[model samples]
Target: MVQNWSVFVSVSSFLLLLLLSKFILRKTRQHKSLPPSPPSYPIIGHLHLIKEPVHRVLQQLSYKYGPIFALQFGSCPILVISSPTAVEECFTKYDIIFANRPHLLFFKHINYNSTTIGSAPYGPHWRNLRGFTTLEIFSPTKLNTFLSIRQEEIRSLVKNLYSYSQQSFAKVEMKSRLSELSFNIIMRMVAGKGYFGAEVEDYEESRVFRRVIGEVFALGGASNPGDFLPPLQ
Candidate 1:
């Protein structure tokens, strides 16, 4: 019985030493290899610090920490680059590892299963899509073919603004007008029709498209809690 107790005590001591060594090693490696990070709390991590206009917050962090700093958005590790030089290096020198966009809900669900170039993972499928875009979609000839549409959209915008200000001094909001102008141009290029302002090809489709665009923009600006806490999703 005494022998068994001695053996058990010896085993427990060994495990305790092993665990302590692992803990110390982890701390040492983290300090050495990882970039500087802001204070983090258990489970939630640095998520509580994130807010609207994330770019401003990121800039502040860059100023506080460094050009390149680490962040813990819940369990996920984020590396933020604020310096142009570092950004250039990351894309040019270490691009392959960082090529794929995060497979988030917006990219996967809202963006038609991440098939789009901006959302697609970096692989042969992505290469094919990129090749198609380079060779067909954004080719100079294709853009030249859409010159009429672009000009017409611009003309319509000028006409509307003129009409709005024809009589006297009038307050005009350029933001929505410009936004709609952009949408009209893109829709004309893609669907061969303008969905906004004067002679929309399909009223029903335009209304549906307007709603979808509105929702997409709204969701894009809004923060998602599930993004930080994956289990919540």
Candidate 2:
């Protein structure tokens, strides 16, 4: 029993040391050609520097770090390219390599693992969707067909606002109303019914969907550490 225990302990220690050595070597190799970035905390990386309204924080960092910098967030490695030249290179010269967006927690949950157009990777699926959108949905012929519908919707919206403006102390939540109007118009065109006027039980569900879509946009608009700290994402 003593001999067996001694062998097990020796093997365990060897494996642990091997793992640690490999991890250090891998990190060194990966970062050898990467851009320079700010110092990060152990384990959490640059999570501490991340703040609400993330774009402002990123803009500040860009000012300090020369636009093209890297950082770690959680276990992810992130690269930020802020300069116009670097941005152009990313989208033009290294377009294919840099086209893939970082997979983040929120996108995974909200986009069904990037099945949607906005989140889908730059591949055949995205190409197909883009083709469909261009050829079928937004083609000149389609737009011409829908012009009357759009004009009627706009007229109704203007009439509603005019009526509201007639009140003694008129007030308008223009943003919310515009969002609803847009949603209704799009839903009508796509489904042959408006969420507001339809007798469907899912009218409320449609509102929920709109709200969730808005939240997703808001979250995406916010700064996220995972974007800068790529490996953490």
* Top-TM-score structure, candidate number: 1
The estimated TM-scores of all candidates read 0.80, 0.73
lDDT per residue, candidate 1, 146-180, as tens digits? 89988999999999989988999889999998999
Clashing pairs in 1: none
Please provide the root mean square deviation of candidate 1 (C-alpha atoms, Å). 7.2
Number of the predicted model whose lDDT against the real structure is largest? 1
Tens-digit lDDT track for model 2 on 1-233? 99999999999999868866765565679777978878766556688988877889999998998879887776667888888888898889999998777676666777888867888888999899899989888999988877776776777778878887886668877886677577777877788655542334487776777677778789877767665444546
**Clashes per model (N, Cα, C within 3 A):** 0, 10
Backbone clash pairs for candidate 2 read 54-223, 75-231, 75-232, 76-230, 76-231, 76-232, 77-230, 77-231, 78-229, 78-230
Least well predicted 10-residue stretch by lDDT in candidate 1: 19-28
True-structure RMSD, every candidate: 7.2, 5.0
- What is the lDDT of every predicted structure here? 0.83, 0.76
